[model samples]
Target chain A: MSEVQRVENRELQPERAANQAAEQGWRDRAIVPPVDIFEQDDAVTILADMPGVTPESLGVEVKDHTLSIEGEIAVQMPEGVSARYADLRGSRYARYFTLGDEIDTDGIEGTIHHGVLNVRLPKRDTHRKRRIEIQAT
Target chain B: MFRDLWRANDPLFGDLGRLLRMMDSNWDNVGSADLRSAPRGSFPLLNVGETDEAYNVYVFAPGVEEQDIEISVQDNVLMLSGKRADPADDEKAAGRNWYRRERFSGEFNRAITLPDGVDADRVKASLKNGVLTISLHKRAEIQPRRIDIQAA
Candidate 1:
């Protein structure tokens, strides 16, 4: 199996980047959430595991043959409750995938449930395989 | 002879390097990055903490539903079990090319030993944004009490 390619986002404004770095501490960095890609006859499905992210906090954008997914993790702490032990803290999750022209970008659909994001990219009709029948001579 | 010796050592060095990288990756995933002690299980990463009134446990399990999860406390041990469904069979049968597959899917179970003061009967669990937050209320006798200072 081919290794998953990791891409880093480089479009963040310097000021905002600095502010985010400061807010999340130096050790906390944007993590690439694990994903599974499945191909069907007519569409490709992508599932991403992003814990602590709500539907409202997820952003999916496709531009210039690139599909980008970003999820913001909001750790809401009830008032007066402090952590005595912690493992999974809040952090941003981001990933990107390059799409081929055969994909019908306009027909793309995405849904988020239980912190899992599923994206379906339908193939263009022209790109789908068609069975040609042989004429009896 | 020297070239032959070097070639013989090449795999040994390569194996050592690979082993180191494996250890590093495991540490990154199972060690301090988790912000807790070493992981007890492999599937869902967990965080456990305690407050004055309750013990808090957070399970990071995405793509799972409350109905799919099972939680029970027995003998001061909290057991969690659930299954993460895989993609539809039709998709798999279509023979799609996979560039990468990292997400874990299948049955998983984790057992955590509760702290001494936890009140099993009062434990409450809720699923939000794919994270399971379990609150184990502390026993009334074990909860901290503020002592009143009398002015003499």
Candidate 2:
């Protein structure tokens, strides 16, 4: 009986917690778009899925050493057209982060194709860890 | 009548339509250069297919469940819509420094126009393992047939 009660409590706890979190607007529930990140040896690559967001509808800004990506995708139906189904809506896409001292923002590059965005951030060669050799005197 | 059914039965599709409308209504607000400048457009890749009978498009939308997909066809036009809800939206929203964002959150919608004679009524759609598959049937009038050549 105790075990069952404990399990029940565990299940209810999440709901209660979720309710509380919802009130704060800080729940893991996303009200924003989606994004993916990858790390490379000398740089990091970011890929975000922004369907309907054409190359002309996005914006990236950097300030105070912090990078922010913002944009909007506006899809136009064909002439004399009406939609029967759709999955995307127009909304703001945004993300921001502070860069570490080791990063070289000057070398950063990005590209957008078919609604997919890619950004490359390279790290400074001096900041990269390397092995040193020593010879006996 | 149809709109009512759609709204009650398929909120995802409804949301997709909303997105399309928003984009269309705000065309002047969008710019290719601006969109390219942002990180929101980044994605790995997508898959598409076309056959004599119909065209099939599949998107790798991980974390998207079957019920999340919404597909519809009207007047030989097909639309595919779905959302990969943000994993970090509901709880623990703050205090997490987002070093980078590549996954799409909120809502997503995709639309394609079908060729003449594509059977919108017989169209079928399915979702499996985060992949959304849409099959547009070809109308009988459009299907290629071997007509017998009559001798003059």
Candidate 3:
């Protein structure tokens, strides 16, 4: 009897569907978008695939050196459009990254290209490789 | 190496990253760019919906060029195939080192069966803003009614 009760209790936990709001009162499900991060001589660029997201719905925030990116996909059914079915649903793409001290947070720049979000973080002056010139004595 | 630095930064980082990776792997059917070449997991998830007039299909294919996409219909099957270019190509042209990669690139093909009555010949497709929308119209005329040998 105790075993069954424990199992039932675990089921009642806050865990819920990915597309449903259980923990937070968010409207849509939050998904982690795929990303590509590369380091260059001057900056580090992060590219994320965020489909169905419009320019007005995308958000990028940096606080305490932790970069957060989120894009909410808006779904508005036009007249005569109904009986929807299939995998694509209304959801939000959210992802977070911890920035290292070498990154110059103030110098960050971002843009969206065909639903792909590209964010470039410039490196600090002290961290960038400096080409030392040889002195001929 | 990149994971180690992130793990050392915060204790919650490990669990958070693990959970996010798990989700991304499971829901990779749409907007995913998995690197593995063998499995070729589902990429650019699609949605086929219906209305009174026709059926509409929406495919999420970010970063894919229009010229790279090919669409065809045969035997009531709609085939969507395309290649999403790798953004790292630009990085490589310039001297750069990769720290992490998760975005999907390369070729992917997906096929969805149409209803029995759809007129495959009347299908129309268009690509805009990385999203491909295809409209398949239903047969306009009803099937000819069968008559007995003693037709009046």
Candidate 4:
């Protein structure tokens, strides 16, 4: 039960007038999708559950030691279909993580399959441990 | 450890746990038409709807393949079961440390009681982009029909 701090931009909710006025235009509310993060010896992997997001609608970016992920879900209904018991609806998914210096940002790779986003951040060469040899005189 | 903080005399941490529980309850009560009566905290939340001729059930199950999912209708009860493979099982994920694990893995099952007059034999299911949609057609006798207006 390791606890990881979750940072959410609560003020970004569209319903808040004060927050909305500061933004450029109307923006969809973004929900933070649940994620599982694993730190291997050579790399760190992140798997986020972002259902409804297709590969074309998924975006992952890393800038200024920060990693950000965004996914947009397109909701479509048949012509004759109508919602009777509606609960989960299409929405935006957004999340951010602070990357450490040991991470090799250039080697980072990401993919989305079955609406899940998988990100792998490799460790820099200098960050890997190396054994020092002792000279016998 | 969090247990130590929970037992501490400080009220700040005490209030934090209480607030988290409150938020969970609030989320559970947000929706209006939850007819299944399923217990709270079920993974892969679902949405059920109906049209003139059929009922639509959508299961929000990301990262699951069609082969991993099973859907069946028996005795007017619709059952959905699926497995979300654990990412840690990947060879590249060996010898890793976990900082956070919020996404649910493993198998999950959910059952929903369907309304009468549904044609179980006509049910169809499809998985697209991780969303499993099941359409249960209604019987011909139960489908809504408009009566022709007679000229007066």
Candidate 5:
């Protein structure tokens, strides 16, 4: 009874991203990070790849049935070293999902390990199959 | 020439850069008749740079454990080989229903050629947030020498 869908927006799209530019927008500009979505009997798990992103830089929000994931990748250079080449594509990453009522937003949990972000969304009790008992005559 | 063609489609170099990087990667050395013709796609994309004393390489390989990876430089070619085990393919996810599977998982191999002056034995590697960075020190004899000029 529940479903999760990506919230498509222009900011994540390259050609349409210019409108979202700000003073610090060059580093804030984001591209849609690819994800793997799986559903289990009790909950749905979403895994996103955002390398170079620490837990402190990651953001996960749920509001009005919408879920958003955003983060930035900062290349750390040693004190004497200067950055000369960059091919990580971009520094920012973002993705969004629309949640159905069956999802228990309050019980959601998010964790990041080695730059892989895991978001678990549990299902509501009403959405689970209930076991019925037989009446004794 | 091809660069001009790619830029024509999207001036911002959105997806085109990824495509070009895939084609431009030096991922050859697969066992084949021609070692230079290895297949190219998206897997572990990387970046490279150099400091005055050493050369640096950054590998973007997310969702991987350090124990699963092996790094070495043989014959002046830096090689990185590793296995990325996502549960989707294993017995753990056998009965689970998958709505979408976009992230990649499995074994990966990457190799980049290094200049002759590097000290292969002095290479240093570290992993943080799924990105593995490696630095190869330059041989002392080949380092750039500065002649101090005394002001008269």
Candidate 6:
């Protein structure tokens, strides 16, 4: 029984290694940017720092209550100039978030200022916390 | 209309065109609504600190006048409120539609909870440019004291 268990372990190691490599590959292929989420008592505020996005270039879409933010950054190469630093060249950002049922889609508001996208997702009125006062006799 | 007719089948393109037109027209037509009615809260960055002498608080509120801001401290909590009104002449000015408008304006409020031992009565605030700096003196009891260790 020990020999059979050792053979099974050896066979599973390669599959596990392959799965990790595939998962890493998928992550590397993704282009979604990072977002900061702050959950408050009344609503959840999402701040997505998209540095090079212009007001005209930003796009927000809500479908099936899933919010999606898309933006493009243009890094134009100067004419008659050989490029030296090109780390941020041709970079664009896209992000999608599936909101929970507790979120009130109608109450959601979005604002874009100085390349930062601020999204306010208000919770349902019933889901919001309320204080109850008790009378002392 | 010609471009709209050309892309009538492409809803996405049509929507983009409509959005572009709206953005372009906003500069000349945006006064139909006031900033207070717009639902998004203002973004204000604040910094608070404490020292042996006093507590310090700073707020970044650019493009706002010193007269518009109000600062008060109560119950150890500092409240900063301000309103940046749009120019009255903006409503009548007409021009080619704007491609983009990104500046933020109107009422904003920020509250800071001060740690215990701060002297709220001695708090002083100053606004320069867009930065509002406040100084709060600390009570003598909260100041640190160094005691000499004697050989026993």
Per-candidate DockQ vs. reference: 0.28, 0.06, 0.34, 0.32, 0.29, 0.01
Q: Is model 1 an incorrect, acceptable, medium or high docking prediction? A: acceptable
Clashes of 6: 0
- The parts of candidate 2 lying over 4 Å away from their true place are A1-31, A79-87, A132-137, B1-5, B8-118, B121-152
Q: Would candidate 2 be rated incorrect, acceptable, medium or high by CAPRI criteria?
A: incorrect
Q: What would the per-residue lDDT of candidate 5 be over residues A18-90, giving only the tens digit for each residue? A: 4334313533458677799988778898999888889888899999999999988866866655443344546
Clashes per prediction?
Answer: 0, 44, 2, 0, 0, 0
TM-score for each model: 0.72, 0.42, 0.69, 0.73, 0.73, 0.38
- Compute the lDDT of residue B50 as modeled in candidate 2: 46
Q: List the candidate 4 regions with Cα displacement exceeding 4 Å.
A: A1-27, A131-137, B1-36
lDDT of 1 by residue, A17-111 (tens): 66555544522657688998877668888989888888788999999999999999865655556444333433788899999999999999999
Better model by TM-score: candidate 3 vs candidate 5: 5
Which fraction of the native contacts appears in each prediction? Answer: 0.59, 0.11, 0.56, 0.64, 0.59, 0.00
Candidate 4's residue-wise lDDT over A34-121, tens digit each?
9998887688889898878888888899999999999887545556665444335337889999999999999999998887888999
What C-alpha lDDT do the candidate models reach, one value each? Answer: 0.72, 0.54, 0.69, 0.73, 0.73, 0.57
Task: In angstroms, give how far residue B41 of model 6 lies from its true place.
Answer: 9.0
Please give, for residues B1-152, the per-residue lDDT of candidate 1 as tens digits.
Answer: 11111221222223333343345356445423322223433668776666678877788899888899999987566789999886644444456767568987889887766657678899899999898988888889989899999999
* Model 6 fnat value: 0.00
Model 5 clash pairs are: none
Per-residue error for B123 in candidate 2, Å, reads 9.1
Interface RMSD of each: 14.6, 11.1, 13.3, 13.3, 6.7, 21.5
Model 6: per-residue lDDT, tens digit, B14-96? 32434433443564244453322212223454434445676666554544667888898886667788875542225532331
Which of the two, 2 or 6, has more TM-score?
Answer: 2
Q: Write the per-residue lDDT of candidate 6 for residues A19-41, one digit (tens) a residue.
A: 66654443343345446565656
lDDT of 3: 0.69
Residue B79 of model 4 has an lDDT of 84
- Indicate whether candidate 1 or candidate 4 has the larger TM-score: 4
